[model samples]
Target: MRLTPDEGDLTARAFARLDARLTRDTGRPVALALSGGGDSIALLRLATEWARARGRSVLALTVDHGLNPESGGWTAFAAEAARAAGADWCGLSWDGDKPQTGLTAAARAARHGLIAQAAREAGARVVLFAQTADDIAEADLMRSEGSTLGRVREWSPSPAWPQGRGLMLLRPLLGERRAVLRDWLAGQGADWIEDPANVDPKFGRSRARQALAGAAPPAPEEARALAGGRPTMDGEAMVNVRRDIGARALAAALVCVGGGATPPRGARLQALTARLRAGENFAATLCGARIEAAGDAVRVMREAGDLGRRGTAPQVLTPGVEAVWDGRFTFRAEHPGWSVEAARGRLASLSDADRTEINRLPAATRGAWPVLIRDGALAPVLAGEGVERRALVAERLRLALDETTHEDDLISATR
Candidate 1:
């Protein structure tokens, strides 16, 4: 269904609608990931209106991935569009020369990398993408080959930098039809440059875009409904989680397993067997540490990080490291090599309920406790007195393991 005109004043109104949907859960500044495309231009025109009305700022960003010679020109056009909209704007470039096996994936990686970095520099809270419902529909169809489970995420933060931490990488137009955006832009007499690569069959998203061109748009409410429920914690709680564990740590708990070494090729799948053994929503893909069900087993693989952060630094798996940011806290094994610290924490003894509650804590009341972890285990016992007594019993055993544990550590040794 086409979005109603009254629902939004201009294309920026569309952006306003989207921002409202996304920020309903996260109250932060919205950074538009602009590319001078029709959809993005439409959003820019409308976003500025919305931002002005609400007394907020809209950061216009364009990522120039030098895959095509035209990318430079596109970036310039995007800058002009941002200026016309009166938004604070920045343009960033990416050299696509770094050899990558997959062109589409690599370009996407590069694009997101530039935008995420720009958002960081601007200190913006959320990065908004002009992804339409058509994209969602294409992604929905692609789910057959693990595309559905792979691409469709309720929420995805920029893994490139923690700066985009808790910043929702949102598809504000996920429920809107592309034609509506096109029509809206046409109504405004706004012209946007089209990327020729979009027609190239080599790019997966291009293929999806082509398929979506011939399809109908989904209901905006339907698309919004897909995002799931409100978070248990507030902004502060989220900030704490990002601070203590870093976003990757909690992401690891949800997607990765404890292992000293990288798994062979798709080790993520193998670890996923544990999840599949328990039954979960993951699908088959070697995207990162997260694995999906394929046949009787799962595929295991290293998880992907933000392009800017990837291939530059070694992963840290330090135990007992805490990241405190924006009033929220998180604890995790920071050293990526081998962790012995997660074993030392007394918080591991807490009942699952207490752990869940702690993890669900709001950002406002994080206090000094800050959800501590060491190596790879929770340390509620050491952090506070509210921990379950049963956890204290396990604390003694964990402490002994921390003391006497070695490379050849045995579970039976503690017992």
Candidate 2:
């Protein structure tokens, strides 16, 4: 349903409140991912107003994924909209060759990477997305169809660090419907571009959206429940407080600790949960992560077998370009051709002091710990040795754990 004028004002006020909270936590300006779509354009407009009143900066970043012929024009249109809304604007492009298969997934990853990079360069720690209630409902429907996609949290730490650079993605419009946002824009005499892909039945999201036409939108309570609680993870284990959390949060934790891109199967996760509840000491592996039950807690660590199976292929680390090696650590070397590989076997070659220092980490993590090589010899660079390195997997685990562990505070703030 369309939003009334008063409802639109309330939505703007809600955006302002959410933006203020994020700014306070991150202590940085706001960065909006603009796409010239109704939801994003509305966000740009609202964010511009909010920032102006608070004397804060708002950057609008338009990422051209270069997938469609009209993507360039779309970027230009987004730029114009941002400028009209009194926000600083920048255009980013995904320049590399697109993958033939999984084009949508590749383009999405590229878009987020480019946007995160731009936001970091602009000194913004929080990137705002224009996802609305309608989108959330559609995603829920897709999940019900066994899509294996996770729910989008209102506040999420970037999964890929260095490239993401510790940026937080904030979806402030999750409580607002898309039609309401469009109506608000219409009232303001603003127009938005309707991407042709939105109606294409080949896209799963498009099909889901079509299926949602006569379906009742997700209830507010259900949406909040689906948003789930924050995660709590100790260095070695994730505390699974089942009643306070959901499968998606657990899956995210497993993926984060497992260092795998895809999450474990839902059935596998459920079985693990049952085992944990049964209070049986057991060990299982899924999604490249090893889960070991230990007295009411489940410890998640990188699977050694998976690491060994990855083979000793050293990835070339280029200067200024961030790369996540082995899905464990994000690193950018000062020089080119710096090959990053597992620290296994090579740890003995290290000096006594270096070995001692590296031993402080968990034994399971040591095998996958980043070790650099240059000219076929081990480089002296280590994680804390003035090197640009971010433990992405560990960071994700920690953040997700923290969020779930202290979910009450987060829920209270949202209320």
Alpha carbon deviation, residue 257, candidate 1 (Å): 6.7
**Model 2, C-alpha of 365: deviation from truth (Å):** 4.5
Q: Which number leads on TM-score?
A: 2
Over 4 Å off, model 1: 1-29, 145-149, 152-156, 159-163, 218-252, 256-415
User: What value does the lDDT take at residue 274 in candidate 2?
Assistant: 66
| CA lDDT scores, all candidates in order | 0.48, 0.70
User: How many clashes does each candidate structure show, in the order listed?
Assistant: 48, 7
Task: Supply candidate 2's per-residue lDDT for 403.
Answer: 43
RMSD value for candidate 1: 14.1
Please give, for residues 1-415, the per-residue lDDT of candidate 2 as tens digits. 4567755575566666564455433335688899999989988888877777666778999988887899988998999889888988999988988888888777887888788878877777677898877887888988888776667766765544346635667777777777777778887789899998999999989999898875656633222343345455554323343332456666766787766656676788888766766677877787877766666555666676677886867778777777777666677777665677777767777667778877886676566566777757654335433347666554555455434322223322111
Q: Which stretches of candidate 2 lie over 4 Å from their true place?
A: 1-11, 24-27, 159-162, 214-216, 219-249, 260-262, 294-297, 312-327, 330-340, 351-365, 372-394, 401-415
